[model samples]
Target: MEYDPTLPWYRRLHWQVLSAMILGLGVGWAFGLPAANAIGWIGELFMKLLRMIIVPLVLTSIVSGVASVGGGRAIGRLFGKTMGYYVLSSMLAALTGLLMVNLIRPGQNADMGAAAQQEVPELSTPDSAVDLILDIVPNNFFAAASAGDMLAIIFFCIVFGAAITGLPEKPRVVVTDIFNAFFQAMMALTSGIIKFLPIGVFALITKMVGETGFDRFAALAKYFATIGSGLTIHLFITMPLLLIVLGRIKPLVHFANLREPLLTAFSTSSSGATLPVTIKTLREKVGVSNKVSSFVLPMGATVNMDGTAIFECAGALFIAQVLGVDLTIGQQAIVVLTALLASIGAAAVPSAGVVVIFIVLNAIGLGDNPEAITIVGAMLAIDRPLDMYRTAVNVFSDSCGAAIIARSEGEEGVDTEVRH
Candidate 1:
């Protein structure tokens, strides 16, 4: 675009982000670590605010969406389609990563000496999968909500929504209208918060860069290259092709509508924080029905982490290789299955990916020692960039899912103009 010099400063998200990033980098480099440390607090504050809203927003939106499904059969179909798409897309993303990493052999020459300086901390092993499933049932809803336990929250929302559906029509209408207003209000609030994203992103990026410097990139070059290359291939090749062939939408137009949210997600690195932008872009710009966008985006943000799932599987394999552990074909299959399940269990909370990785490592029998956890710490050091890529994938996957769902609902032709 065009710049309106007369417009207020906050009216321009791009300008704000660019300015913040440049200024933050200058301050970080010139003033050394102290300035960067102070600025980091601002990013943490922004994430805290967004996270504070996620549970309530997800609960309300999901309950409302499920309640809109008029009957049991309708609800069943929607659930089937939503979950089916998540599984397929996530598995494809994981497999794509595996293929690329193996083809490139990015970790073949990894320097264990460089990784020697890293300190591995002892971590408690994760509970079994059965225990993880059992933990989904909240002993106390208030505690679960307060803790932002996503699976429990989702469980509660579905039950609450189903109950609302079973109510009389007049009462159900009022409840639905009330929730509609609630969701709209939350969206508005989210939009207001997003205006501050550039500041948050700048702080987050500058602090990370200042602490690690550029040398860390060299040390983990192979790992980074592997993940980055996989992400690029998926974004440019797999996703666009899928959109064109399966969704029957123009990929160029679809991407144009997605630009703002995708960029915001890249910069901010929190899919939960990016949810407002994703929903707005999907419904207003890409012509996805509100029914589909509302139902899919929130759930996708929580469960459909295609990028992270791929990274977890690929990263695990890399770790196993570096540790000189040869995994059988059956074990590799287990890795794929466990990564898919772990991605769903992984919440959208801050630094939650680290926990998810730990869970994955434990499942693969690497959790007995500090080596696996140290690998994770190394991954965490470069997580900002990886997070950006993954969030984009997450948003892209959600958009495609929304398009497919819209097509299924016969609302694909609702609008042709790009809404961004």
Candidate 2:
């Protein structure tokens, strides 16, 4: 993580993005409304570029990756390994958050009485398990892709890829090559789009800072700090340790290779939005095969949300403290499970973590309080900065899982890339 004297500063994409962010913050703070009016479109353009290729990249990558996984046994084996890593990582994150909130006790002496005027959003109840099941099998394939039902698209892609593997050898090679070719083309487009990242980060950060100044942080700094601290520990400590112990890869080398997607995730605050960069970075820079990054990352973007699990767990506990409701040991345990499971089918759920906090609160019988709702409303107003941080953690966890799983699967040079 030190300065590489051999590599020129201007050549480092991460540092360029960081510099853009700092400059954008100053521009936004100084110009306010004018800043947003002038430069917001650039950021929007950047997002559109990132999003434009997602459906195709995901479709081709998974189809190609899964189809090339060798056989049915390999597909299932990789599935089990990926899901196991995802579950274990998210569970650990929930535990870390649970411990952090209890230690910090940020909501203990808080004043929420005057926050009645903040606009509270309606509670977003997550769908039942059966509804999630129904969402997976799309009634219409192209319709689902057009509607951006990633869960449906993912399920279909998986089945389609598996079917390809079962085809006669001559036809199977033809289909796999077609998909592999498409995936490479999409990746080239992704690389072109990523070259504009610094500009996009600058504009996006500028717009955000211009619109919402620092005044919002006046209240609920403690809650923000709570989430921040918990995420920091999980990001730098929990995940790296897991990588070292489980993946047997050099964490620093892995980290250096992943700067683009991490910075992209932070600026965008959307794991799905930053996925093309994630996939491309893993393939070209981190040396993860399309076989693992392709399969693991898309699903991870939707299903494995370690950061969201931590945020929801800490958020629910913080809300409980604000309401003076001391959760029982059993209730706290329920929070842990809910937070972990709530992230399962998140692609189909809008604001999956934010809306689902009520699910956690209601699990502990605190759902119907008028004052608590207002506090939640108030908290929503100041959540963007923390949202950005946690989104980065989410992306990082996905990358870590890819690297670890790739290493476990015996992908040589995985996380050992030294691209300058």
Candidate 3:
């Protein structure tokens, strides 16, 4: 809510990352492969730092988030409706990305000789739906955590945290506090790592451009277009349809009411930071009651990230396409599921979806590939603006959920309690 408009532009994170990327491009273009090979290690090291934080960060953030959900029939129905909307919306958003990527085929015929350095390696798609299911519930939690298997960790933590909610008050409080503190600690650690994003972006871009000579960047433009189109469909077509059919609210009025929060979300690029404005707009201008707005908006901000979901699914598939790896139907399904789960974990970090795209790539068996990080770093270089757009879609989806749920609950004047 508070911003210092007078601050110098270069002092901002996005601008700094932009400057680094431009510098990387110049150095690589002028000096060529030698420059790329020299600085590539720094970028790889930055990515390694990211992988280092994943296990603890995923474990703590998810469990602590789910632990906040209370148990009882008093709010059970409301909880179910709220969660159903979040889950369904997020799935549709991701599926939109999946559809667009396959149709556009943005990564087709991309020249990666320098980047791939060999024949296109076969994609490591998921074996079967049954195997994927089995993989989700690991035999040993600690073993899964140690192996850095995110799917198993996410499943166990969700179930574990839900069970904690059903526990007696005293024990629940004790356990919840521990995870909460640990989650904060991990976030602080992540914040520190995110600070080096410019360095990482610079190294990755310099290496890729140095080797491949900007051909991939052409594909990157198409890739960016693919994501943008998917997000636009989900934002304009899908969300407005939900508003009309589900909430019975006029899309025009709702958009008008949300003008302030959407702009704030776009500028800040953070749903968490824009929460105060989102809630106030939904409750005051859009005409939802306090009870509905308070409960739904907070949880939605945490777990209901529709825009990020689309980005994750599309990003993983685009990476596969770029490396000429064909993802199987089951593997695509895995991308969808991973995107959903990663959206929940994404809430705790600075560059939420950008960081989690690595997780989606890893789930689809591409994490170990050194080349994957190169493209990811390129994506990071252009991420700030993309992040802004998706984040607005995210906040807008949350408001729509609150409005629809309030209407379904038989609350009068839903989206009509006040007019801006």
Maximum-TM-score candidate? 2
Candidate 3 lDDT (Cα, whole model)? Answer: 0.75
Task: Please give the range of 10 consecutive residues that has the lowest summed lDDT in model 1.
Answer: 116-125
- TM-score for every candidate vs. truth? 0.88, 0.95, 0.60
Pairs that collide, model 2? none
lDDT of 3 by residue, 1-420 (tens): 223578787765556666776897899899889998999889778656766776676567657756775554535676789889999999999899999999998778754443322222232333445766777788999999887655677678767877888999999999999997986686567667766767776886677567656444453677779889999999899999998998888887787677666755664466765565576566557777655675677667767899999999998898899898999999999999988877766652335687667778889899878888777777765565578789889999999999999898787776662253
Where is the poorest 10-residue window by lDDT in model 2? 343-352
Residue 190 of model 1: what lDDT? 78
- The per-prediction tally of clashing pairs is 1, 0, 0
TM-score of 1: 0.88
Question: Scored by CA lDDT, what does every candidate get?
Answer: 0.75, 0.86, 0.75
**How many residue pairs clash in model 3?**
0
lDDT of 2 at 148: 75
* Evaluation by TM-score, superior candidate among 1 and 2: 2
Instruction: Compose the digit string of candidate 1's lDDT tens values, residues 44-159.
Output: 88777777677767777777778876677877787788898899888888888677667766556677457524333433323677877777688998999997666677777777
- Which rank order by TM-score, best down to worst? 2, 1, 3
Off by over 4 Å in 3: 1-71, 111-219, 348-350
